[model samples]
Target chain A: MTKTTSDITKRTSIGAQRNPASEEAILTAAGALLSEGGLAAFSIEAVARRAKAGKPTIYRWWPSKAALLLDVYHRQKGETFYADTGNTRVDLIAFLESLLGFWKKNGGEVFRSVIAEAQSDPAALEALRDYAVTRCRASGIILERGVTRGEIRADLDIPLVMELFSSFCWQRLLTGRLDASRAQLAHLVDAVLTGFASKESHAQ
Target chain B: MTKTTSDITKRTSIGAQRNPASEEAILTAAGALLSEGGLAAFSIEAVARRAKAGKPTIYRWWPSKAALLLDVYHRQKGETFYADTGNTRVDLIAFLESLLGFWKKNGGEVFRSVIAEAQSDPAALEALRDYAVTRCRASGIILERGVTRGEIRADLDIPLVMELFSSFCWQRLLTGRLDASRAQLAHLVDAVLTGFASKESHAQ
Candidate 1:
């Protein structure tokens, strides 16, 4: 029987040492293609052509397209800004503003594509969940700082609170509301920080 | 030039009065297809074939696959439960429980598909946004009741608060976390109702 493309790919990739330069080229090309055409125009064949890398080589390094997409996203997201303003509300708002700004610039499309991919691929979903957990833990430092500073309650659920904040951001990004004003962000922070119950209700 | 399928469909659909029976059949078939196979297997062609209706009939009425999908979602979501326990926290929790239960039952798959569709189609995005606004308004009644009963602050941002609640639910649903326990739901409600700030900070 003739060797199929998968057979050839597996044969070629076996014991082949990964080249860092090729990986960088592949990632850069993937990012540019995604930015230029969005997810609909993204494909491994396209990435191979753009990066001058062989298709089997791309597949050998990245197990799946979702894996490659996730790497590109991580590469694009160089560093997350964590603001500590000596106040929970201010710190949270500043952090969100910085995050949203990054999203509006380029992160939104890439992250949105990841989320959309998750809807159809279980591996993508797993990757997204793992990434979200890591980011939440990193961002939870703000709330932890608030706790240490005596601004927030010590017993507060950090994971849940961070989930709330991330959910708000995700909704905005997915719905194309990345331009949320500072006032709106302030309102969201206030709602989380101060609650909405009347003073009378709290007293009761 | 030979008459194309589009021409035939357009010619056949123009001035053709809608049959409620056929409409019901189409909606029913679309819902069934989605339930069995999810979005990957969903299409107007499959819907038309399943409904025993011509493609033109389906296209003539629904206009687009997104329109038909939205209709199926609406039809599947018969009525939303609005709980009023005379307490904002209890009412919100109960309402969310009802909504989540409905989502877990069947609405989750349908709604997830719609959200996935919105990611690629601008029309679907618009439809999703319009539907969200309408649903938010409908659900805002619970918060409004709280305002009337003096449980919540009169100046509270109803739309914003409802948005937070919806965003939380959407995140959970999208991330396959619809199985949130009652205790977790209570925690969310408490976080929204009591805030996370320490009493001393509030006093200061």
Candidate 2:
């Protein structure tokens, strides 16, 4: 869609210099649109209209809808709590609780839209993978702390463990199970931390 | 979209009686469409055109696009292998290998679309959860065999473990990581079966 004169004036006043204020406005508008209407209501056109910024200006920075969605997701995630309670199981459980709670609040829908978008858009898929990698590394620190404290096996695959944790959360989020109880989260963490093998097998 | 005369004729001859041939034709057409175009290319209209049937006929039986997608998914899943070697780890690894292989082939895209569709459609989400419950119960049978063989702890939460396994596979599939190796799958199973507690924690 061609930019109208008003769009030009808006762009010049707010976004021409790539100022943080314009970026915040765009991100806020996108998040609001997503929260209000879900993925079906989200689009460059919608975001531009709501933000009063020109489409060309948005494209100048975000590149794709997925990128914008990812930013919205990250912005919300910045408020998520990651626990470090000096105990791996406890820390893991607390981390899960905070993460799931954040998701239940509103972050889940935003992230869900991102996942849905990734299914159809190559750029979205790439953005998703890259985001996953970054989150994996950051979250692996929990496992690392456990290793350091001798609470977890040093040889344990931290990345795999992180994937297991994330997969559990992702499945719950996608399947409308974000209301998983604290006890359930604890059970999951305990299962991961302590093997499920029968005592006899462990002895053997 | 209104049905043409040929559409009515095709529907009457093949689908009026809900014959096996027509059901198979519609399902086959749906699967082919999903496989070729992913979720974006899938719809009742497209399936009607491809199968030479009316959209009403397709909807009459499937009810919703999600229902149709679920059927297409189940049809492909029928070919998946679920092992029962009397060993939980072996069986789990083998099952993952077969499931991942199936996804890497074509099932991943179809299933991914189902997940994507569920994000925006309540009917799709319901269908997805219903399907997950069925799959979880069936797959839990593998772990039950382990319990019967005294290889697993009877007190263990079967449903939770099942969720872990499915969640792992779902994450890998959704993130384009369906190529996970046997070694990785084995590690995951072993972690679950043997627990990850440090030596000291186990002694306690």
Candidate 3:
């Protein structure tokens, strides 16, 4: 059984009544189905069947297929481990490497599902944008630290920079290219950051 | 009635058999259908019915929906005009502004369909990637000209730069965000080119 986004909100007030274990089971099952079957085979019914939960249980946690998948995507992402080494370039590269690794290993399929769904469904696009917003803010920590340490310009637009960074990753994945080599990733971060650090940008 | 990739190749050898007007009508119908209803409403059947051509007429030229849609995308892009001012900065801003405008008005819907279809189907991905490759090269001209004029770094990686630039556009489109303003586009181009130009990058 899965808990809907709102259900989780409600359950937060009283954790004793709802079993948290079912949420894990449901998400795990959804991930398995996605891994083996792709988006075409994933559905609320299929997830419920695989998890031995009623369809209502899945519905309670997510209102639609995209919703369920979004939860799965976030859950999977929450587990990818990376750290700040107190160096902007070093930290950014490590962060992107972890991200690219995760995408190659897991996030690619899930993101593909979300992006594909977003193409036609406005709701899915909103959810994806919401997710992107969170990740962008989180990733901005690298630049934030960089600015504080004087490794990055104080006036750099963090949001636009992050958008550019993610755009590269998503574009490559959507195009079915291999995960970029560390060298390529290094080039990207260096290029964007260099541009930010330059006097020409500051003059504007 | 639009020509297939192979058909175009064969046509180069034998140029007399094709009717340019029907080809134009089929492509125009496809662009309109994609504009009005997106991928769901775009089909060999719908296109044939709309163009008053037989299904075989479409298949004879396109072979598949992805191919047909690719042609439509290319046709749309071919019509967007932008100048290559001798100044790299000016030319890039103009180019990106044109792209952003195109995506906002028309390319967004069509690109969303192609990107969405590519996510699910390998063949569609190949077609979309082919389009991307061509566009990437074409856009690379800005950087190439910059290098020639001693404005951009001579040793910069063109392919990586193109990936970054396209990533920004596709990312915005996929996330359902408005195109970055021209000032923002200029900022991005300037930032990226600055990064490429900075001596630190060359030291690597």
Candidate 4:
């Protein structure tokens, strides 16, 4: 697992040789298209048209339509962290709160459309799965750190915990009830962390 | 939470009776259409025509397309519990395993279309949300029972726990890699339960 984490880290830098400017332009255009008209409006042709780049340039980088979307998901991951708040409970809550807020403030609309497309399209589902796995792996780092520090249980099921964490966001995202308020987030963290608490000590 | 569960159960039964026969027919047609054509091929007209029922009847029962799809989801829930195996760990695993099996048996087609429809269509998302909330509330009852039986932590975050459980299903549902084999399920349950374990009895 540790090796896998390092490998994922290494792969992140491998794709750096591609023209960053073109990739950025494509992502920006794609984001705009996604926001303006949802998945139906997102097309390679439109992305090229919006980015002022040729279709060949777009196709050269991304293998398919879903690949471009996944690039966006990857880029977003580079910007978010799971445990930066010092306190594990606070960090968990803040991570979720920020994610929910981000969804509502920036990512919600595009995500909704992505989810819709993933439902019906195999390609889009692949993109979403990639995003989910990537995010899970990233969050695993934080949980692993928590485990190492004895803040979280060492024998914890990282994938399941990550899945649980991710699901909360998905539930809120799908429902459009993404509230990042501290109180709500605190409650969520408290509840989840309680699951990690040792039962015997609490019995006393 | 118990009250909420009862309310949903009551609503479901009442809702079931209103158009049980027509609803079942529509769902059958809709499910078939989804299996064959995905979201692109799903439509009220197609369902109505296929079910041999009038469009007006479909509309009368379900206010929107997503609502019709949701009825299909509800109907699927009525089918059977995948595996009980007695142990909570095995039961959860069996449930997830069956879920994955169902998708594979259908060629990973039905849910793919449903997810796609859910992404772009607000109605679809709403239906998903309604179904999710209802389902979560129902699962919460199971958790409550677990708590009562001393199998699960009393302080577990009900909503968060449910989210975690559902997310595993969603990830598998979206990715078509629902690898809930016996070993994988054992690992997952150990990790989750360990993470949720109380501090006094850390030996397990």
Q: How well is each residue in B1-204 modelled by candidate 2, as lDDT tens digits?
A: 123434322222221357688899999999899878877888899999999999888878776788788888878778346677777888888878888888888778778888988888887887677677556656766777788888877776776768878888888877777778777888878877877778887777
Cα misplacement distance, residue A149 of candidate 3 (Å): 2.1
Pairs clashing within candidate 2: A194-B195, A195-B194, A195-B195
Once superposed on the true structure, which residue ranges of model 3 sit more than 4 Å away at CA? Answer: A1-41, A45-63, A79-81, A196-204, B1-41, B45-63, B79-81, B196-204
Query: What tens-digit string does per-residue lDDT give for candidate 4 at B1-204?
Result: 436645545334222235768767878999888767876788899998999999878777676787776666556655344343435555666666666676667534555555566666777666666766666655555456556656667766565466667666766777656766667766665666555333532342
Q: Candidate 3 has what TM-score?
A: 0.76
Model 3 C-alpha lDDT per residue in residues B1-204, reported as the tens digit of each score: 123335322213211244678888888888888778877799989999888888877777665688788788767777344377788778777877777778898777778888998988887887777667656655666777667766666556665777777777788888877657777887776666665222433344
lDDT of 4 by residue, A63-115 (tens): 56776866664565455656565556766776787788777777676666666
DockQ of each: 0.52, 0.55, 0.39, 0.38
Model 2 iRMSD vs. native: 1.1
* lDDT-sorted candidate list, best first: 2, 1, 3, 4
Better candidate by lDDT, 2 or 4? 2
Alpha carbon lDDT of residue B52, candidate 1?
Answer: 94
Choose 1 or 3, whichever is better by lDDT.
1
DockQ comparison, 3 vs 4, better candidate: 3
| lDDT string, candidate 3, A1-204, tens digits | 123335322212211243579888988999899878987788888999999988877776565677678877777677343376877777777877887788898788888878899888986776677767656655666676677766666656666777777777788888987567899888767766665222433444
- TM-scores of the candidates are 0.78, 0.79, 0.76, 0.80
User: Per-residue lDDT tens digits of candidate 2, residues A1-204?
Assistant: 123434322222221356789899999999899878887798999999999999998988776788778777777677345577788888888888888888898788778878887887887787676666556556777777888888878777777768878887888888888888888888878866777777887788
Best by DockQ: 2
Least accurate 10 contiguous residues by lDDT in model 2 chain A:
A7-16
